[model samples]
Target: MMTVFDRRSLLRTASISGRAALAAPGLLRAQALDEIRIDWATYNPVSMLLRDKGWLEQEFQGDGTRITWLQSAGSNKALEFLNASAIDFGWTAGSAALVARVNGNPVKAIHSFSRPEWTALVTRADTDIGTVADLKGKSVAVTRGTDPHVFLIRALADAGLTERDLTPVLL
Candidate 1:
């Protein structure tokens, strides 16, 4: 699977922490950044494949660089890690990345993980819900600040509805 990269705050934190691998190549080249931190999520098969194959480790082995795997529960957690300087790279949806950027996270999208739409709205087969419009005034469980949340927002908007039309139970 392919992966997306979010370049963290290199200019702002590079001077103080010497941790700017994601910010730019020059900063990393200038410093002895021997470790790489990346997120791993079961929901993301691409990340899981990378972890399982150890391909990254193989490539960086000649440099004696270490690979650290951080498990991210969702895109929100991945963004949090990126902002907190806990990880150098993370996997997040395009929409979530946009939201993070708008919310003051100095990050740049560097790749596309996959072409698949990773989230959708669904209900039990027995439920009467059949379409996005049917979701109005309904309770939907979603992980806030992630792809699902963004997808829901866009879906609602496309259906001529707003978040106020339904109860969003944030997970």
Candidate 2:
């Protein structure tokens, strides 16, 4: 059981200027959030930066928020944890988020944390393949409904190929 003071402290960091504080009237008395916890899913540098810097913890230490780092294997796994209430917050890709939404997972993207394109396709140098069209009738490996999947779909479309034209292996 959390005290009213604890809840107010937990919610204090949620505001930038006193607006969020002013907006919610006696929110702590309502929620008793003395033991509020947040779960984080981090697989990249920005997450690492936030964690390493202890920004969130620093903000919540006074409020008694116990920050727990949840290691997730992938977006799908992260979504599973979220659905199970094992995590309160997560870092996921846009495509993965959409897939989770389509699959009935309840989540909202509060921010876009990254915008760098960070994936590519490669083949053996001796294969002699010249273009995306050459991949038809072949097998493509990608995490389904993820960025790689979307990129593959676009590339294949550019080459006049559909998923039906080849085997898509989800990884």
Candidate 3:
């Protein structure tokens, strides 16, 4: 008899192997897990999709692990939850993750799920603020320690302006 492998079979085998490897440590402990807290943010469509699909529940069904889903308003809240040990896993922007790491949060970036444009500067339709320079001396609404804040800062800097040049309404 001869053994043959196709691309789909190879991928399926790899996926199963990866899952077993991840579960090895927990299985070795021979302890039952009560719950696994995970966060889902509005900005992360994948997280939302997973929660809706009940995939996590299915994965841990045999282990009797409870999948607790926490809602995060933004990266700051997600990072805060992670720092407070409120969540076992979370979703956040790369910039926010870097900021949290820099601020001494014991965090790591394991995956990049999406790369859509996550931040932008907007003004009223009637407002004449067509450029970043026009934002100078204007009050810009932003959430501190979030991707939008980082984007605003970088955009301002690129326009040869700083936060001091404008009024930042931290939310």
Q: Pick the candidate with the highest lDDT.
A: 3
Estimate the overall C-alpha local distance difference test score of candidate 1.
0.76
Error of 1 at 73 (Å): 1.0
Candidate 2, 1-171: lDDT as tens digits: 221223343334332422243235443344334433334445554445555666666666776655676777667777778788887566677899998998888776654544655667788899866788888888878788777788888888898989998888878
Candidate 1 displacement at residue 151 in angstroms = 2.6
Cα RMSD (angstroms) for every candidate in the order listed? 6.8, 8.6, 7.4
After TM-score superposition, the amount by which residue 164's alpha carbon in candidate 1 deviates from its true location, in angstroms, is 2.0
lDDT of 3 by residue, 1-171 (tens): 323434454334433543454465444445777787889987776667667777677777787888899999988899889899998778888778888899888876544544555567889999989999999999999987777887898999999999999998988
Steric clash count of candidate 2: 0
lDDT of 1 by residue, 77-134 (tens): 8989999999888888877888889999987666544475667688999999999999
Point out where model 2 deviates above 4 Å.
1-43, 114-116, 124-126
Between candidates 2 and 3, which one is better according to TM-score? 3
Report every candidate's CA lDDT: 0.76, 0.65, 0.76
In terms of lDDT, the poorest run of 10 residues in model 3 is 1-10
Candidate with the greatest TM-score versus the true structure: 3
Model 2, position 94, has a per-residue lDDT of 87
